[model samples]
Each structure stands twice: as structure tokens, then as C-alpha cells.
Target: MTNRALVIQDNHHQTFDNDAFMQARNLKAEYCNSGTDALHAIKSHRYRCILVSMDMQKENPVEIIGALRHAENTSGLSPTPIIVAGKDFKLTQSDIGRLNISAQIRSHHLK
Candidate 1:
């Protein structure tokens, strides 16, 4: 595994933090509040994997995924891979056929 991961999570979970995950996994992790913030982070650094909250910014993490996959200047990250996380089960089947999302993680059993 690479030593870096970027995490985008909603503000709803007051205690939701990627620090612990980063420390435990020995990764260089960065956190962002919204899809926009995440996009900025992506442009600044290259990550092996990106973990994003599913319902962030109104169940629209797909847009962020799209933006990354379609970045004009950074076109090769199209296959970088992303993991979507959320508290709801509905996101598992989210119609993200247009986005290049890699996986979905349910918050109840989030690792």
C-alpha cells in the first residue's frame, strides 16, 4: 500500500477523523470538508487512494469523483481509485455509473 491517502468527510459526524486511520495505517492523510476542498487537495498532491464520504455535500460525492477523473491538467489519474463512505445503505447502489468510483464503505462498519 502507498503511504498516502486523502479523506473527505462530512461535518455531521463530530468525531469523524482520519488522523487515527492515518496513524494506524502509517499514511500521510489529509482531510477536506467538501467536494470542492477535496478537489483542491487532489490538485496539490498525488495519492494512491482517496477515501470520500458518500453523503458529503448532499449525497453528491459523485461530482467530486467526476471532477478528479476528468481533471484537464491531471488527466492520468482517471484510474487512481476512490472509496466512498456513508452512513446510509442507499449509497451502495448509487447510480454512479458515470463516475469512476472504486468502492463504497458503509459507515456503521467503517474501518
Candidate 2:
């Protein structure tokens, strides 16, 4: 089985960096630059994990999260863990109430 990962980023540079990192770790990384394409990828393949840039401009992050949830529910696919990245990735109480997120880690905590 291939160790595959999907990365969604609005910025090309960020996407390139993420793809390089994943490749270095021996993962088959696929890149999607827009929410629509991300959603399409989610529906079409089983990714080990998904990396989503919170700063995606083509579609709101909340909307993408909702669509992911919907895809999980409708397709009977296991929930793919999503790593939301960006300095502005703060989730409000309302946002937390809307999605089933497990935890939030500060960027500084990452090695």
C-alpha cells in the first residue's frame, strides 16, 4: 500500500514546501490548490492524512470542514485526520461546536 497524503494550500510556495517535506518522509503527496479540488480529491481517494491551509481563499475553511464531514457521512469512509495550518487558525467556540475536533496544538510545540 502506498503511503499517500493530500495537501491543500492556496499559496503555491506553501504547497511546494509541504509536498517536499512529505516526499522526504517517503509519502506520496498530492497537492490541491483550491477547496473544490481538495474536495474532489477527498471523495476520490483514501489519503493517510490531509493537510489543509487555513488561509485558503477560494473557499472558507469552515465550509471545507463541513464538506469533509458530509463526505465522511455519505460515503461511509473513515474520517481522514485534517491538520489545519496557518497563524490565523484559531477556532472560536462556535466553530468548535460545529465540528468534532479533538485538540489544538500551538505551533511552537511542534519540533
Quick one: best lDDT, which candidate? 2
lDDT of 2 at 18: 61
lDDT of 1 by residue, 1-111 (tens): 567898877664633345555677677877777777777877777787888776675547666777777773365653666877666635434455556567766665444
Model 2 lDDT tens row, 1-111:
458888777776542246555766687878888778888998888887776767666678767777877888798987777766654568887775566554443334332
Model 1 stretches astray by more than 4 angstroms: 12-24, 57-59, 72-74, 89-97
Give residue 99's error in model 2 in angstroms: 2.9
Winning model by TM-score:
2
Model 1 steric clash total:
0
- Candidate 2: Cα lDDT at 35: 73
- Find the 10 residues in a row with the least total lDDT in model 2: 102-111
